[model samples]
Target: MADEPVLPTLPKTPFNGLGSKRAWAQANAPPPPSVSTSSDPAVFSSDDDPALEAYESARRHKRRYVGTWYDQHLALSSDSVMGDDGSSTIVGSSPVVYRPQRRAKGAVRQQKRQFRKLDSGVYMGGQDSTDTEGDVPSPYTPKYFVSPAQLRVSPRSLPQVSEAESAARDKIKNCVEYGNQEVDLSGLGLNSISAETIAPIADIAPIPLVVKGVSFEQADPDIKVYLYNNHLKDFPLSLVNIEPLTFLTLRNNDLTEIPTCIGKLKNLKTLNLAQNKLKYLPAEIRRLMGDGGKLVMLHTASNPWWTAEKLSFQAVIEQSDPNPLIRTPVEFLDSNGQIYSRFRLPLSDADLAESTSSLELEVEHPSELEMPKEVSYAEGDHVRLLNPTGARSLFEYALKALTKLPEPELEEVDYWLGVDEGYPKGLRETLNLAADAHRSGGLTCSVCGRGMVVPLTRWVEFHKTAGTIRVDRESLVPFLKVGCSWKCVPARQVVPECEEKLPESDD
Candidate 1:
């Protein structure tokens, strides 16, 4: 309580009627001036009031209301306050000042690009260009193709050697010396060698040599030759100069004849001339029958001469009388009755004549002379006889008479008795004499032994006793002095004894 505080009294002003500062400003500020025209109604003008004109002008500039009247009014009211004049002014204190923001700077822009092309009308980058015109590559090469002129050039050739040089080279390489004494021509490559070249080599040494698959015209004669698989037509006699040759083979050649000098080789044991063209043998081959007859074997099969007709080897073989050293195949047979065994010797003209004479003698007197009937003779069935004696004539005549008589019966003597009566008186007297001699000489029937009669009952019975009838002086008188009537002997009774003494008779 001491000295109680006294409050100050507030003063009334013209702005006292406003509620806020913004309201106070609006009340004290001058009103806006009206727009006028001739056609418009009469209204309040700023010319009629100067203070309103200044206030309206300030408001257009966005100024605040700070006139002298507003200050005085604020001084009278103690609630209205004012700040020091020298301090920073507030933003709303002056409405005429303005502040603007700056715009941001725009981004920087880029420029357009360009390119170049080559003279060949080909587009290229700056990094790919080069300086040369032929620098552009092709897919294939142009120089590999061949031209027509290059193909026309001629080629060089080597020289050829002569035949002499070829022969010399072949001899040096293929010829071999045997035992340092002789050269062997076997398997020597002499394909195109001439005869002149071969002759000199053969003359140097006379040794055994074999030449195959070459012509004989190309071979030398001085060499001891053995030929195989060769074409030789004819061999000359000069080949025989190879003396002391033991064996020779001319198989499968074209030789048609053998040289006569072949017989001169006494040392030759075997000779083979198979598959040749010979048609006949030479006479010189007969001389090969050496001392003791030393020709051993000869093989001449497959030759044309062996199979030739009419020219037989059998005639020659029979004359030769060969030893057993020679052989012929089983198919060969001496049908001509000439060949005996081995050798082929021909018959001489004289020997054949003598044989003919002997054969004629046998057929003329067949009962007296014995000869083989199987063997054919020069004289056939018709044969002549020389100096046929009574004995011979009677023997033949009796056979003729017996054959002419009629056949007799076994029981009777009718035909025989008739024959005896018709006989001549001389024959009848001889028959009586012959019968007396036969009975006195003890001549009897061979089967019954009763005293046999001349001109017996049957001729067969008379023939049986003829062997006992002797042909002595007495017997011959009966037969020759008077014609005999005794019939001839039967063949069966006389065959055995007659066959021993004379040649056999067919009848």
Candidate 2:
């Protein structure tokens, strides 16, 4: 029985001692062309068994060919924590979260995308690097930043009135200075024989005697004196000897006439002679008023001077408005400093809006509006700014935009210099907002020719970081690949230099 089934003698392999040769033949032979992957796979149709489908759906969807590798490679402990009530614990320094992979059905994914090949060698895409510099940040992307362009710095001033000023005021015999600066002139009981407020300290003047904070001792005399709001009557004859006076103020005081010696101040640059009792100005003083331009400014408002003096300064005063909205004392000061009261300045944008709303009412009942009777309350700076023909400020521009007003001129690029040099904060904000609204869409989309709406919040930040056109917001936005939306911005088109043309070999 044992020798009955002794068939053909098989080839002597190392596995001959083993019972079976079928295993050897099967192992030695080539593999089949294909295999069935769906042999015992759990292929549950959603309609077949909703309960099992739901159970499987709640489970994490493992990525093909990658999940097992990550599971084997990542040797962390299965130490997930749960709360007492079977909820995920939310507290702890190292709270571990196991998020499920959510995927859409019937989606196709690229295999082996994590791997990449380069000239040097194959590597993981995460670790793949090139010899060139790193990628640049996009300019249009919203970044958290702002420019100091909107901010206005204040001008430097003395902390308090100097001891010299206090002592000078103390030298007066009759008047007492109050906190509110209110004076009871009747209580002083002094007769109306007015004397000069500024008098010589001693019988004879020293070479450089300082009076009202002006020291005559320094040569190339700098008349950096601000003698406004004083009770001075007569002109100091000593001022006539000075070769050239750069500045002089005879404003807000009681003066009868301009001394003939004022002509001797050949270099009298700025002369503020407003709110004075001068009935007449000398012919020589007229000559000293620069040829409109040579004298940058000459303020002579609220003066009882004859029409000739007012007429001479009127032209120069108007020219002082280099940019209309930005004003100076010379530009804003009218015949009786009445312009400020007439063209009202609002405290804020809201105030401006309210003021603009009231304009129609004022026009309807001009007689009912109480007008300013005198210029007694006017400060040295009368008006904040004069309006452009169309829009004056941000609030005005917004209001005018509703009326379909054409875009007005914007502040010059260098206008920021004025901001840095202490332009009003409110005005700066208004100017910045107006500029943003006006120049918002000057730049076109990268893909389309339609203008881009630059985000004002991040406009300056984008301008600052944009390597190609990192200039002011206005000049910068145009060059950037900006757009109305993300869709409009063209994809970054990288053009590699084609070194296709090679020179002939000259061996």
Best by TM-score: 1
Per-candidate count of clashing residue pairs (backbone under 3 Å): 7, 2
- lDDT per residue for candidate 1 within 79-174, as digits (tens), equals 111111111133115311211111000000000000011022121111111111121122231232111112211111112334543544345234
lDDT of each: 0.29, 0.30
TM-score of 2: 0.20
Q: Write the per-residue lDDT of candidate 2 for residues 1-507, one digit (tens) a residue.
A: 876875464344432222321233442323221111112322321112223234344443332332233221111111111111112123122332332212111010111111111111211111011100111012221121111111111111112333444444454322222121111121221212122322221112123545886745643434333456665566545554444346666567777655544656676667777777764444344345433222335565676532211222111112123321111011112211123222332213353345433212121221311112211233332322221122223444342342233332233322553547675445544445334433321323334434322311110001112222122222111011222322231222111122312222211
**Window of ten residues with lowest summed lDDT in model 2:** 103-112
Among residues 3 or more apart in sequence or in different chains, the pairs in candidate 1 whose N, CA or C atoms overlap within 3 Å are: 316-344, 316-345, 316-346, 317-343, 317-344, 317-345, 370-503
Residue 469's lDDT in candidate 2? 17
What's the TM-score of every candidate structure?
A: 0.23, 0.20
Q: What overall lDDT, based on C-alpha atoms, would model 1 receive against the true structure?
A: 0.29
Clashing pairs in 2: 208-217, 325-386
